[model samples]
Target: MIDRSLFENTETAFELKSDSELERAYFLFKMISSEPLVRIGTAATNFALKAHLPVEKLIRATVFDHFCGGVNEDDCLPVIDKLYTKGVSSVLDYSVEGKSVENQFDNALAKILKIINFCDEREAMPIVVFKPTGFGRFLLYQKKTEGVVLTSEEEAEWGRIVGRFDAVCKLAKEKDVEVLIDGEESWMQDAADDLVEEMMRRYNKDVAVVYNTLQLYRWDRLDYLKQLHKRAKADGFKIGMKIVRGAYMEKERERALDKGYDSPICENKKATDDNFDETLNYILQNLKDISVFIGTHNELSCYLAMDLMKTHNISKEDNRIWFGQLFGMSDHISFNLAAQGYNVAKYIPFGPVKDVMPYLIRRAEENTSVSGQTSRELSLLKTERKRRKL
Candidate 1:
């Protein structure tokens, strides 16, 4: 269990700001903790067209303020500086999703390349990330796995996708920054994995500059990691992988049941947790051949990785392993790990407010659905509130 007092102690290693920040944080916590508020807010925005409501303003004021850096890159600098001062780094993610039109895809490609260029110019940005679904149609990615070849126009569009990824990878390699390709739904993941593998082969000959995300909630991801490792060894290049319990578990399970197929998710949470830790151990053991980012909010899993690092006599600054959590949800973990001299970063998402509502809703739903996490946050806030005697 994480020590609640660690966060309560303002002078502790993680460095909470003056009482003012904590007070503001507490107010935000109270808002998110209200089930009725979250339910109505989610419903209003989710069915806004039918509901004919303008709830984006409320969303922008509450959850957006809590979770996102801002709606774009320039707006994220203050948040980046705040985290950096506390010893954490930031991963820049341009969060535009679900684009299908070729020109729109091309424009997103340019925007991402620009973000990478900006990162190249900044000292604080260590990683640049993008979701494949952000750059292409989901159905097209699904089609690739079915052995359905694309038409001439589709092939040209596909080339543009490859070109965009290549541009990002090449710039990352040149700038010595890491590029993390976010994982997508399972139906579209095979194409993403293939694209990442190709980039890793091309750019990872000397160092790991390209990483593919692995969603371990999928029952087969452990073996997939092993296979990726084998391929990396055969190709004589270091493998880069980011491991998570997964972001789409509920959707994946529901889809599987609806389609009469076995769910790819682990049979139980214990299995998922076990597999996540086991995979961490596997990557640690092969640290020379693989670089891993342990992207999880689970405390035990985080500690297990830390303990393993110590057992192996690995330096806290070892570039091969990093610890990351999303921007707002796990500041306690991210900041505390950074204070301990570990390589840690927050995944900072930036985009227009309207464009990123889906991301925002998913975050709210995640916190609300995860048993006890909100309660824990509430408990921490109340503890701190008591500490301050407010």
Candidate 2:
């Protein structure tokens, strides 16, 4: 087992103050802890925003600070530099969600291309990330999977999605930056998988320029990973896989029930955890053909990967194995891993306050829901505050 002292040292490094910032974080924690209010209010706020209400200021002050890098790429530079100074790398994510317009899709694609270009210019920014839904309508993605032929307009939208991905991958290849495509809802996943497979086939021959995110919480993903490995081996290319425990559990379960289909989600958290660790072991064993980014906050999972690395005599700087957490959560895991000479990056999302509200709310809600995570953070902050005698 990894020593508990590692976490203690990691928490101390943050040097948190017991001032207004800590107080605000506590308040938000309490608010999100109120399960009834969080459920009702999150739903209501999502609805209100869809109805075009003005709540950007509130979002920016609270959850945005806790999750997003900033409002745009330029806005993210200082934060990226700060992480670089701390020996942590940044994966730049443009956090816009749930759009259906062609122009909006095209704009998102253009912005992602620009981000790729920016990362190319900045050596510190090693990974450029995107969600396919950001560049294509969710409904269109669903329809495409259902064997529905697209109309001319829909075909044009599909072209835009392809164009966006191609542009990002081309820039990433040129700049030698890895592009990490995020996982999405099960219904929309087929389209994402198809697109990512195409990109991998085209650009992953030399190095892993494109990565497909696999959410291990899905019951079928382990097998899917194996199949992808087979395809990559047969095609004579490296496969880059970013593994997460998934984020859309509740939504997926509800949708599965509503649509009268079996849920694709793992039966419980333990099952998911088991699958995740097993998948990590598989990837480590197949390190020659696969590059893996272990995007997790679980300490055991992190150590499990480390243990596999040691057993296999894999170098800490292999570049094929990486560890990542989101920007605000799991600093102990991310910073400590990096400090210990492992490749670690934080998933730093940035966008307009209004556009990133969903992402922020998810972070807030996740902190409150992930067993002891919020309490652990609060306790650490308080301990650091007391240590500073504030």
Candidate 3:
């Protein structure tokens, strides 16, 4: 049986965090716990960034440093090496978002290819991540998802997008690195899913080289996974998945309401949690055909995964299963799991300070909106602080 209190070990969780870093984390979470402060901070930061009023230094020292690995891949090496010392791996995430041009798309593809090469060289980094929209325009994906016929020009553009995906996934396969394609909003997800499935069929013939993100908060995802599994089995391929409760909850619900369509999101938090756990169970039961990266910060879910693995006679260090949390959040879950000899990886977001603000702001807003998330982080930091007599 897994220990119920494994995640409460502050010393193991904060061993890498310096005394000042612990205090900074406590202060950051305390500030993030206030919804109003988060809203105001997000607005002010965005305005300051647009105005070019020199807030980048302040943001870099505070939230950016805490949440992100660094501004570039080279800058992230030290951070990645340090985490690996604790037996945790890293997925280098190039987090620049919102590109609309072909040149920008090519740049994103080049960055990912470079990261895959980087991952190949570094023992600490076995995976790389990119968003579907990062390689092409969001509307292109939306058009494809809605089954709308595309113009010749649009088709040519999308062909380039597909080429970009192929380049990265092909390189990852050659280098023996895993590639994770992040999931976006429900409207654009279908096209992305179809594309990722193709990549999996091609590169996952021998092993899982391509992973698709499944946002379990979407009520239809478990069915989607099962269907994908059946197809993979018949086609002689493996299914690689990174499952999460999801981001974009507010946007998804609001869009569904505005369009008078049923929300794709589960009806409530309990339903989403149950859906995540059930999906986790399903993946664990089919580990031979499916490899999962369990992306969550919930301790109960982590404990549940541990218990299930034990029940299934799976070894703690199995390569087919992994636990992942964001770089700045969920130290308790990530580090504690690593200490217990489970495969754990941190998603380390990196980009220029200005370009990464949107990702960081969203992280803060999500922490504030998710009930008890910020409080748990603050409580853990406080416990560590008291233990160190700070």
Candidate 4:
């Protein structure tokens, strides 16, 4: 039985950061907590880059440095070492988005292989993560999901995409590293899911080497989980999944409204939360055949997981369950969970400054949109700052 107040210890959570780092985080969160400021800042940053102004260095030092590991694999070694010192695992995510060429796709696959090899040696990096859109054309995947038959050229292009995915999973199997395929916008998710299921069917026979992310904000994901579980169980394989509230809510609703179809997302925060918890319960009940990754920032959801674990008599250090939060946010949850002997990991994204800008922008928008997320983080940082007399 773990104490409920375990996450209240801010000192241990912020111990790795210096006084200056904490101060910078406080100021950054304060600026982004306001929706209007985040809106203006994003627009200004985009404009500055377009107008050939010198903003990359400033962004690199501020948000990029705060949120990302570095611009490359070698740059992430030190960050990995630092997190390992605190008993937290790192998932190195090659977070460059908006590329669809075959060359770029191959390059992404190669870098991911490098990451798998890097983790092959380091225990701190237990999982590798990359989104399907990073290596596949979003439009092509969307059309495929819509049941459109591709022409010969497009078919060849998709063949290359599948070939790249096969290489990643094949190497992951050999290297003994888990690869998490991130979820994307609903329009293209069906194609991604189909491909990911194929990967899991091929690679997850003995172990959960490949994971598919499920967004609980969707209205049908709870049922989807049950059906997937049935398939996995019958097929004699384990299923790996990362559960989240999702990232593309605004765009999802807008697109559904534009297309004259019902929105796939939940109706409200309560509905999302309820479905998420129920899904967690369902997964927990089948822990022997399923590996679940809880990727959330909500403290209540975290507690619910803990209670579920206790009820199911699952050990805290069970490798089948992992708690993940993004780097530079939710330190209290990440660090405290690690301290409690739980299998905890942090998502550390790395790439070139320009390539990673989209991820950084999403982080800013998430802080602004998620109710009181930035404010709660700021409060914890302020408390730790005051405690240290910084």
Candidate 5:
């Protein structure tokens, strides 16, 4: 059996971090553990950016440098290479969000396509990711999700969105690089699901070239995956899924309350954990037909996945299964798993500092909201620091 205490090895976990970097990680998590600080800091950062205050350098040096790889793809090469030396791969995510223009969509598409090309060239990068909204407007997706009829102009615009998805997936297929399409709000996910399913049908005939994310915080996602599996089997195509506990729980609950509808999110954190584990088991049991990218920072969920893989007799190096964590957090899980020869990748968010604030702010808020997440990070960093006598 694999070592149950594998993740407790601080030496293996923080081997790549220098003394100063370790202290920085500890300090960052300490700050994130306070809920009020995250709220006030988020507001202040947003205001500063809008008022043209010179906070970009401060952000870049501290949170941005820690959470993000760099400001662009080329700038990320050294980080990508560094992680690879320790057996972890990198997924370059162009994380600028909330754009609603044709040119912006085109720029996002160009960025992803370029990242795919980078994946093809670099052995350290085997996968690329994009958000559905990155290729089109959010309202367009919401309208289609709610079954509203689109005007002719909206239809033409959506057609461009489809073209963008196709262009990336096609290049990904040609280059043999895996593509992960991120999940968003449930109010607009139906349309995104249909579009991604179509991409899977086109590019995943031989392998899972295009993957759709499943935010398992939604209780219905396992059923959704099961139904999608039936369709994939009937149609003779593979399935790729990146499953997460989700990133928008507060927004989801607020929207449900405002609209007088049942929340799509699981009733509570425990339910979400159960849902994630159940889905993980299902995917591991059906690994031959479905590939999974397990995106999580929870130690229990990570352990559950490792146990499931062992019970299913799956190889540690299986390409169809990967364990992923965000770039700056969860180094214990990522490096420990990689040290044990399990397939692992870190989602490395990259963009200009000002443009990436939304993503960074969300990260900070999520760290504060998720119980024990920030504390676990701090605890691990402390352990590593003590081990190093820092």
Candidate 6:
């Protein structure tokens, strides 16, 4: 077993932060912890960006700097190297979202190909990630999921989407790097799943070069995991599964109500947490057929995986299981795991600041620790600050 004080070593956790930066992080987290501040700040920030105001500087210095790696791939190299020094690998995520055109699709494809090619050379970089909606049009994918018959133009658009996907997967296979297909809303997820499944059949025969994300907050995902494992054994291909608690909670429930369909999400956070842990156990039990990236911020779940690894006598450096956290959040868990010799990676997202604002706002709102004591993030910062006496 690894040293447990690694979790309490706030000095290492905040090593990259200056005293001023630490204070700013505390102030920002405190602001967003209040529901009213987040609501007003989100609206005002959006308005400023849209109205050609100079809020970009303030934003770049605050949330954007904290959550995102850089404004583009080249800009992230320094950050990537910094993480590597402390034993954490980087997963370069192209963060541009909500684009829907052939050129944009092509650009995203080329960008991911660049990431994969870059990963081919860097030991510090492990896996690469991209969302289905980043390049493909959301409405078109939603229609395809709903089984709408596509006109010829829409069919051609689908072809472009498929080509872009195939191109990325093929390169990943050739380069011997894993590519994670990030998850999105349920309405369009089936289309994305179908595409990822096909890619797996083509590239995952010997090893898992392509991965599909499963959000365990969905009530059906446990059964879905069973079906996937059974199919993988029958079909003779490994399944690369990245598991997370769902992201689009309110959006999923709201749309289900509008459409008069039963919601796909778990009824409560407890159910989601249970299902996530159960899914993790199921995957670890069947380790040969399934490889998982435990993409979570929950501390208990992380420790549970550690205990399971110890029970199974799995090596700390095993390639089949990984721990992933976003770049800025959960530093104690990430750096501590890395220091303990586990395979740990940070999802390093990069893009134009405006294009990445949606992602930043989501991080801000989701991380607010209004329920009780400070958030795991805020408290860690406080601990580090007190240790340094800055």
Cα RMSD (Å) per model? 2.6, 2.5, 0.9, 1.2, 1.1, 1.8
**Candidate 4, 210: how far from true, in Å?**
0.6
lDDT of 5 at 191: 99
State candidate 4's TM-score.
0.97
Compared with the true structure, the alpha-carbon lDDT of candidate 1 equals: 0.81
lDDT of 6 by residue, 1-390 (tens): 544555778877778778998898788777767888888999999999999898888888888888888998879999999999999999998887778778888888889999999998999887999999877899999999999999999999999899889999999899888999998999999899889998998999988889999999899988987997788889899999999997888899999999999999999989998999999999898888888999988887898899888988888899989999998878888988888899999998889889999888887777653243236667788788788886
Q: What is the C-alpha lDDT profile of model 1 across 125-185, one tens digit per residue?
A: 8888888877788887888866688899888777878888898899889888898888879
Residue 148 displacement (Å), model 3: 0.4
RMSD of 5: 1.1
Pick the winner on TM-score between candidates 2 and 4.
4
- TM-scores, each model vs. reference: 0.92, 0.92, 0.99, 0.97, 0.98, 0.96
User: Lowest-lDDT window of 10 residues in candidate 2?
Assistant: 9-18
Tell me which of candidates 5 and 6 scores higher on lDDT: 5
2 versus 5: better TM-score goes to: 5
* lDDT (Cα atoms) of all candidates against the true structure: 0.81, 0.84, 0.94, 0.91, 0.92, 0.87
Model 4 clash pairs are none
Rank all candidate structures by their TM-score, best first, as comma-separated numbers: 3, 5, 4, 6, 1, 2
**Local accuracy of candidate 4 as per-residue lDDT tens digits, 8-97:** 789989999999999989999999998899999999988888888988899988999999999998898898899889899999988888
Root mean square deviation (Cα) for candidate 6 = 1.8
Predicted candidate 2 versus true structure: per-residue lDDT over 1-390, tens digit per residue: 445467666343473323676667667666776778788878987887888887767777777876788998999998898888767889988887778787887898888888888987887788888888888788988988787888998897788788888988988898899989999988989888988999999999977889999998899999998998898899888889999999999999999999999999999999999999999999999988889989998888888888889899999989999999988777777778888888989899888887787777777687667887777766766676576564
User: How does residue 82 of candidate 1 score in lDDT?
Assistant: 81
What is candidate 5's lDDT per residue for 1-390, written digit by digit as tens?
A: 556788888898889988998888888899999999999999999999999999999999899999999999999999999999999999999999899999999999899998998899988899999999999999999999999999999999999999999999999999999999999999999999999999999988878888999999999999999999999999999999999989888899999999999999999888998999999999999887899999988888888888888888889999999999999988889999999899999999999999999999999988898888888888888887887885
lDDT of 6 at 162: 93
Candidates by lDDT, descending order: 3, 5, 4, 6, 2, 1
What local lDDT score does residue 150 receive in model 6, on the 0 to 100 scale?
98
Candidate 5, run of 10 with poorest lDDT = 1-10
